[model samples]
Target: MPSKSSARLAALTVAAVCSAASAVALTSPAHADSVRIHDIQGSTRISSYAGQKVTDVAGIVTGVRTYGSSRGFWIQDPNPDDNPATSEGIFVFTSSTPKVAVGDSVTVTGTVSEYVPGGASSGNQSVTEITKPTVTTVSTGNAVPAPTVIDAKSVPARYAPAGDTAASGSINGLTLQPSTYALDYYESLEGMNVQVADARVVTATDPYSELWVTVKAHEHRTPSGGTLYGSYDSQNTGRLQIQSLGATADFPKANVGDMLTGTTAGPLDFNQFGGYTLVANQLGTLKSGGLQRETTKKQSRGELAVATYNVENLDPSDKTFDAHAAAIVNNLQSPDIVSLEEIQDNNGATDDGTVAADVTVNKLIDAIVAAGGPKYDWRSINPVNDQDGGEPGGNIRQVFLFNPERVSFVDRAGGDSTTAVGVTKVHGKAQLTASPGRIDPADDAWKSSRKPLAGEFVFRGRTVFVIANHLNSKGGDQGLTAQYQPPVRSSETQRHAQATLVNAFVKSILDVQKNADVIALGDMNDFEFSDTAKILEGHGELWSAIKSLPKSERYTYDYQGNQQVLDQILISPSIRRSCKFEYDSVHVNSEFNDQISDHDPQVLRFRP
Candidate 1:
């Protein structure tokens, strides 16, 4: 299981820029020239003067940063250029502490380089930066240029232009169309000071001292006050990541639906995470939104309540144990069965030949019981040490918690990490040969990934098959704001194979008994609208339950402000034919600042 590298590589990158700067040093222009900022940043994504040195690039210091790995100052020309397709400012990358301050007009002589935030391999757009600078202050107390306003009407409705097919759908070769595409408009203002007034918070402030807001107020607003990321086609163009140039301690915390009152002005920067981010020099006041966590009602005696939650690589040593227990007890209403993802090894990430998760599972069960929940029993096979991918040594896997009073686990032993589970017919009923067994564990699809765990359960004398899965994540995929239009999903092929395996397993149970109740649930790690989901539902063997929610309420995970789905609960034909099921993508941790897990829990109440 891999994680998203967007935020991990998001912060203002300096080392890679310095590395790229040296690589292009040998390609200096034959003759040095005095070029305007607009001349340096051409009409395309890549700068026309890249790898060439410029003399006396004149501009006023709009913002300066002496902290962080990227210590530099943003400079903008007071006399603005007429063409909207070219930027009037650029970032002067000073290796150490910068000497310049705001309102100081400086002439810098430096090499114009295109620094791709997460490197070229990440498929991120290159940022035009003036690296290895020699700065000279022309005047003190000079007037900084007025900030450009970015609002609902300013950004284009369209996200980006189609890249040339010859270049493999890369939009870098295309000319900037600021009026027609949002990515082009943002590129036209790179490193220039801009502002958004009274922006609405679409994502809660993260521990990285960053948050996200939407300039387009009413664009795909969800009930929880976050913008919905419905599809790849409709990427909300107005969503911009906000990070302050101020101290991290002084940064304000806000939740979804909160407002940053007044104006937040800053220099537009292209980063690895969310593409165009505003490094705010002057931040706005934060106003509370009074957002609260949701609670689901208890299941009726006839209804079997089931839930899936990713505890975010949880171990016995984590501090969020009580909070997580509360969420399962109070918010989730203590479901009869729950599929818990990311339960780490016995010693957490120590990785000393340990594979058991008894300590990790027992602690959560104890906490649940202490929080007025049931004395739930659990079952799961320990993954082979370091074989499953996750936090290096933190061998995480899915564990099932069931209340013995309500349901009984079928104990047909011989389940292990590498053994594949198969379906057998018993008097016209479907049963697993080995309960709590891994599904197709020997296949390459489970290589360095968590294998789906299948278990047999009997509720009210009726057999049910539950497959808990934490599939391969979207780690190697290109981002939405990548230089290539629609970006590359390199991670999808492995996930597609994984989905096909699980779908075939579900089909096996149905082939024996068509009405077998099969419930596949957990962090699928792919969207409901994605090909992974489609493959998991192969030939109508299964149907994803998340689609039952309205398009606006379909998300269970929020990343860089766009709420989308990465967890799901899908059912077999018997369950779907009943048409008496209720699904809830409960909003708890995703919208709140104090969260135990990054993903929200999902609950399904149905009669089996």
Candidate 2:
């Protein structure tokens, strides 16, 4: 699970895994001892026998992992200690194909060590393992220990415990209380065999043969069957990632709401990326739940439809143009104005000083027309080559596509990637000095991030100002399953500043002309209930349209197993008060296994 390919292992690197394990190379002559697996695991997360040698640690091989960088065998003691604080099972890191089989009774002699994935700077939890293990198989065909069943009754409702402030809020030193906290419950069974019956898939199976399931059914469930991560306190603790010990191609391809029919049992592993996971040797049978992608109703002629979609670094070389065009035309119902994010250069990511995306954008336009949609005119400001933070060479920027038959783009001169758009008064109304301009391009808040693109549009003779944004991502933030309780989100600082800048810009426009029709929307890389969203809606300057929907239906993205809000459409008070507000967080990709993008498009329909 420490590989970088899967989401559950993104935080781990080979350097970190090797360094942590090999740091304590105190190799002494092996001496027979009565030391057990639990003695090495100890009560806390760190091993008490760390930097020491343990010989003749008896256990039965429960699972064998013969591939990947972490190729090893999981040995679980048949006769576990009475205490639930320490794990009975431990991983034998052979560093290659293991000469062991499941049900083999064996004794291992190795150096007890703590391998911290992603390094110590990452604040991730360290897994206790026996590195450089010399194992001797005592017998074969021994019955494995019965798996500890994990269900709604076993896992506690409380997600985590507050760490001691004296230790910088880290829970590493604290004793595990299995009945008090869910994290502790999972940690108590770390590396030991566990099972969940009839587990419902929350996150669709990813491309890397990984999926997520929840042991606690109906815990903050969405209408689409995903567990909701609506607030910080409600982190959906029942969710657990699943990976198999068998062939990767044999893994099930499941979507959200699909069911795992029988018992899904395996070694409960504490991973760096997705927290506690089931490295399943016995996988569950798949059963479809009839989940389908949703399509929004077409906008009436009287009502204006505006949508924001992240095409996920669309380029001329991508084959998803037709699928995206179908999603725009057929699913989004050909919105009058669409703010498309992540539009790359013509040769997308081929950094040859080529910044123009006419081919890329026009090809999509052509696909849209071919899909029986209107011939939409587009406007965008090309960003500096490789300045925006995305794929290294992909100059991803926001582009606006407006149908001339329904709406017209208010194009003015002198707007470029570096030029900041200024709000001014014209005929007792608000107007942009340069249409299709970047908002505060020189500001430090937008450094290494996509700058907000401000564009002007006229619909039914009423001017609407749209600011499309793709702010700084949530990189470098500690995950939910860090060594520290309430993991730190350092990336929120930049996003908060970005939100404040956008809020000020919106206020500036409203200051000149009260009740201006302004809509700020895009992949905010945050939740609607987050502080970033609160800053964007500062002093009621803008209202997040996503909140208009019920809490169960507000998600636009799926991460791990929690359905959350990363894309949003927010409107000024003018549209909120004057127009009949209607918003839909479109569900096309986030809930499907075959996804074109990780984010779902959001559409708002209103009359002005």
Task: Please tell me which predicted candidate would have the highest TM-score against the true structure.
Answer: 1
Candidate 2 wrong stretches, greater than 4 Å: 1-17, 21-33
In the predicted model 1, the residue pairs found to clash are none
For each candidate in the order shown, give its overall lDDT on alpha carbons: 0.88, 0.87
Error of 2 at 544 (Å): 0.3
Tens digits of per-residue lDDT for model 1 on 1-608?
Answer: 24433446444445224454333233446446888888888888888788888989999999887776778889998787788999998988887889998999889998888877767688888878888899999899987899999999999999999888998899987999999999999999998999999999999998777899999999999987899988878689989999888898888788999999999998998776778889998899999888989999899998888899999999988998889999999999999899999999988879798889999999999999999999999999998889888887889999999999999999898789888888889898888989999998889998899999899988888888899999998987888889888888998999999999999999999999999999999999888989999999999999999999889999998888899999999999899999989999999998877778889999998899
TM-scores for candidates 1 onward, in order:
0.97, 0.96
Q: Candidate 2 lDDT, tens digit per residue, 67-112? A: 6677788999999899988899988888778999999999999877
Worst 10 contiguous positions by lDDT, candidate 2? 1-10
Candidate 1 ranges with C-alpha deviation above 4 Å: 1-16, 21-28
- Candidate 1 accuracy as lDDT: 0.88
Least accurate 10 contiguous residues by lDDT in model 1 = 19-28
Cα shift from native, residue 42, model 2 (Å): 1.4
